[model samples]
Target: MRIAKEIRDDRTVLSIQEDRIDAHNSGELKNLVLKTLEGGAQNLVIDLARVQFIDSSGLGALLSGYKNANLRSSGFALAGLQPRVRSMFELTRLHRVFDIYPSLQLALSA
Candidate 1:
C-alpha cells in the first residue's frame, strides 16, 4: 500500500504505487483516503495507473472514499485506470458512478 501524494491544480492526487489493491491493503487505502479528506482536501483524485488488479474490497474502499467526499461536498475522481482494472469497475457498473479520466492531466484539468 505504497501511495504517493501530491497537490496539483488545487487537487490532492494520491497515486497508488502498488500493482494490486486487494483485501490485504484495501483498508490502508480506505484509511488514507478518509484521512486525506479529513485533512481538508477539497478535491481528491486517485491515480491508479500502476494498479493492474482490484477486488471487491478495493472497490468498496474507493466507494467509501467517494461517499465521504460527497458528504463533505468535496470532489473525488479516479484517473489512469489500467484496462483490466477498469473492467472491474465496468462489470460492477461503478464506472458510471465515478468520475474517471484517461490520465492524471485530464483529471486535473477537469
Candidate 2:
C-alpha cells in the first residue's frame, strides 16, 4: 500500500503515493479509506496528485468511499487529479460525483 493517511485540522487527508491503483490492492485501499472515516475524521480529502493510474477497482474504491461518507453524513472531496485520471472520471461521469479541488486547502475549505 503506497497510501498514507493523516488527520490535520479536523480533516482527513489520504495521500496516494502510487502511480497506479488496481484490482490487486483496491480492497486494501478501500479499507484504508474506511479506517480513516471510522477513526473520526469527518472531512475527507483524497490527494491524488501522485496517482497517475487507476483501474476500475480503484474507481470502485473511490465510489465506495464516497458512499460511506454520504451514509455517515460526512464530506468527501478529491484533490490534485492528474489529467489522465481526471479524464477517466469524466468518461465515467464520476467527475460529477466528487467535489474536486485544485489543492488540499481548497478541498478542505469546501
Candidate 3:
C-alpha cells in the first residue's frame, strides 16, 4: 500500500503513495489507519493525492477508518481525490458519508 504517516499541528496525516487501493492492499490500508487511531490521533487526514484508482475494498477500508475515528470522537477526512476516484464515491453515495476536500490544505483546515 506504500502508506506514509506524519503528525503536524496535532493532526495525523496519512498519505497513500500508491496509485491504487484495491483488494490486494485495502486490508493493509485499513490496518494502518486503525493503528494510527489506536496511537491516539484524534484528528486524521488521509491524503489520497497519489491514488488514481480504487475499488469496493478501498471504500470499505475508508469507511472502516471513519467509523473507528468517530467511535473515539475523532475527526476523519479525505483529501486530493481525483475526478475518477471522486466519481466512485458519488456513485456509491459514500460522498455523503465522508468529508472530502479538493486539496490537502483544505482538508487540514477543515
Candidate 4:
C-alpha cells in the first residue's frame, strides 16, 4: 500500500494510493493514519480518491483509526470515494458513522 500525507489548511490529508485495502495491507494503512495523527493534526481527512476497493479488514482499520482520533477530541472523515467504495460503506451502514465529503477540498473547508 502506498500512502501520501499533506496538511491542507489545518487538517491532515492522508491520501491512499491503492485499489485494494484488505487484510493484506490494512495494518499498514492503519499505521499510516496513526503517523498522521501523531504529526500534530487534530482534524483527520482520509482522502480515498484513488482507492477503488476495500474489504472487512480495511473497513475495520478505518473504524479503528477513527475511534483513536476521536479519543483525542479529534475525529476522522473520508473524501473522494468511488461509487463502488461508497456503496460498500452504505451497505455496511458505516456511511452514517463517518463524515463523507465530495472531495478533499470540501472536507478541509469543513
Candidate 5:
C-alpha cells in the first residue's frame, strides 16, 4: 500500500509507505487525506519517515490536507521526516507552515 492509516488518540496518522511521494501518487495521497478528514479525524498527522523523496505535487497535497484540516477546525502536523525530506521542506519554507516533529511519539504527545 502507498499509505497506512491509523488513529492515535485524537489524531489520525497517514504514514506514507512509499520511498517517494511525487507526481504519480500525489493525487491519490491528497484524496486519501481528505477522505480521512471526512471520516472524522480531529487531528491529522502525515508520517514521512519512509519517504525519502518528495516533489512540488507532494508538497501541494500536504498543503491541501492542511487547509482541509483547518477548514474543519482540526489540527495538522507532520512527523518522522528523513533528513533529505526535511531539507526539502526547509528549502521550500514549508517548515514554517507545518508543525514538524522528529518522531511520531513527539507529534502524538504534542
Candidate 6:
C-alpha cells in the first residue's frame, strides 16, 4: 500500500507503488482515498499503471472512494491501469461505472 501522492493541475494524484491490490492492502488504499478526499481534494486520480493484479476487495475499496467522492461533489477517476487489472474491471462490469483513462496525462486533462 505504498503510495506516492502529488498535486498536479488541481487534482490529487495518488500513484500506487505496489504491483498488487488485494485483501491485504485494500483497506489501506481505501483509507488513503478517504483521507485524501476528506483533506479537501476536489478531484482525485488513482494511477494504477504499476498494479498488475487486483481482487474484489480492491475493487470494493475503489468503489467506496468513488461513492464518497460523489457524495462530496468531487471527482474520482482511475488512470493508467495495467492490462490485467483493466480486464478485471471489465469482467466485473466496473469499468463502465468508473471514469477510466488510458494515461495519467489524459486523466489530469479531463
The lDDT per prediction is 0.97, 0.89, 0.94, 0.88, 0.91, 0.96
- How good is model 4 by TM-score? 0.93
Model 6's TM-score against the true structure: 0.98
Q: What is the lDDT of residue 68 in candidate 5?
A: 96
* Candidates 2 and 3 compared by lDDT, better number: 3
The number of the candidate with the highest lDDT is: 1
lDDT of 4 by residue, 46-106 (tens): 9999888999999999998888898887868999999989999999999999989988878
TM-score of each: 0.98, 0.93, 0.97, 0.93, 0.96, 0.98
- Kindly state the number of residue pairs that clash in model 5: 0
- Model 4 accuracy (lDDT, Cα): 0.88
Tens digits of per-residue lDDT for model 5, 1-110: 37899988788888899999889999999999999999989999989999989999999999999999999999899999999889988999999999899998899998
Range of the 10 consecutive residues with the lowest summed lDDT in candidate 4: 32-41
Residue 107 displacement (Å), model 6: 0.6
- Pairs in steric clash, model 3: none
**Residue 78 miss distance in model 4 (angstroms):** 0.2
Write model 3 residue lDDT over 54-102, tens digit each, in one string. 9999999999999999999999999999988999999999999999999
The CA lDDT at 71 in model 1 is 100
lDDT winner between 1 and 4, please give it.
1
> Which of candidates 3 and 4 reaches a greater TM-score?
3
Residue 47: error of model 1 in Å?
A: 0.2
Native RMSD of candidate 4 (Å):
1.1
Candidate 6 on 4-103: residue-level lDDT in tens?
Answer: 9999978999999999999999999999999999999999999999999999999999999999999999999999998999999999999999999999
Q: Which stretches of candidate 1 lie over 4 Å from their true place?
A: none
Off by over 4 Å in 2: none
